[model samples]
Target chain A: AQRVTQPEKLLSVFKGAPVELKCNYSYSGSPELFWYVQYSRQRLQLLLRHISRESIKGFTADLNKGETSFHLKKPFAQEEDSAMYYCALRFMEYGNKLVFGAGTILRVKS
Target chain B: DAMVIQNPRYQVTQFGKPVTLSCSQTLNHNVMYWYQQKSSQAPKLLFHYYDKDFNNEADTPDNFQSRRPNTSFCFLDIRSPGLGDAAMYLCATSRAGKTYEQYFGPGTRLTVT
Candidate 1:
């Protein structure tokens, strides 16, 4: 079974602080991992993908196959960065279906 | 700009009544998907259309049906919505490939009364 787990329901941080949202997956096959963010009154959009190996809005995530984890990290948090973040995974052999984590709400306070 | 569009940002329907949610895309992507997201829960895939090929999830209920009339338009029909069916239905589109990313719409918040 393909599953994603985001244990924290909320992660509050002060502006300029480093932030990290944890994500773990249960899959034996090669998987494509993604991080999606939804801002207030905005649509859900892609923030980052493991395949691209690039940072977006100063956030980056690295896939660790040994741990089966793809954790999202940022050097410094901003007020505009406060949003709901979801970690998703796609099974390579499963017709390209996406499986999402429960999500983590990042509240960046000044 | 080319993007995915979902009509009726908010909807209110009586229990056991039928409701339909519409999605259209200007990106001309080859794949369209329908997802149901409950409050505080991750979005769950219900069904998707790869061009004209319809694919349904194994756990999807028979009451939930989808139709793709053309390349740009797709519809999700709930034959008899229940109270538990109230959720935000998300529409997304992607090109047929392993790397192409999916673009999501603003989503429709369905309220079952």
Candidate 2:
């Protein structure tokens, strides 16, 4: 079974500071990685997927196959960026059954 | 707007009682999923409906069952709720067959006492 690991349970940063949320996965086959976010009092939503290679809300993650990592990154964090983030891995063959990591709560303070 | 919806955002049920959580979608998606999430824990996949077929995870307790009468509707039934069943249940939908980006509902909070 594929599994995702999010090393940090909580990450705190000041506004305008750079932030990185680390994620690693254990899967032998080609994996499709995604970042999902849940804001306070909001439903969980897709942030970005590695397949698209497009950044959303100034956040981007690069898939490092050798390292088995896909870390969410932003050059400068904003207060609005505070939320819970989850890393997920979708199997190439499985029908949309996602293996999610324990989420990391990102806190951006002024 | 096409979206996933879960009703009764909050539910409270007595221990060993039966409770049902409803989910419906306007997207007509063929895949619907039920996930259980505890505070500070990852959302665990319990089961999903692929078209008219139902698939349950191996570790999922027998207490939990799901019914999808049609493409637009699905229900998660807990036969006998326990204190440990208290958690947020999330419903998600996706297109048929592959790992498509899934859309999630606001989630239903189930509290067992």
True contacts kept of each: 0.64, 0.78
Q: How much is A79 displaced in model 2, in angstroms? A: 1.5
Local accuracy of candidate 1 as per-residue lDDT tens digits, A1-110: 78999999999999999999999999998888999999998888889899899999999999999999999999999999999999999886776888889899999999
lDDT of 1 by residue, B1-113 (tens): 99999988999999999999999999898899999999999999999999999999999999999999999999999999999999999999988874337799999999999
TM-score of candidate 1 relative to the true fold = 0.97
* Tens-place lDDT digits, model 2, residues A1-110: 67899999999999999999999999988999999999998878889999899989999999999999999999999999999999999886665689899999999999
Give the CAPRI rating of model 2: medium
The candidate that achieves the highest TM-score relative to the unseen native structure: 1
What interface RMSD do all candidates show, one decimal each?
1.7, 1.3
Tens digits of per-residue lDDT for model 2 on B14-92?
9999999999999888899999999989999999988899999999999999999999999999999999999999999
Error of 1 at A83 (Å): 0.9
| Candidate 1 residue pairs in backbone clash | none
**Which regions of candidate 1 deviate over 4 angstroms?**
B98-100
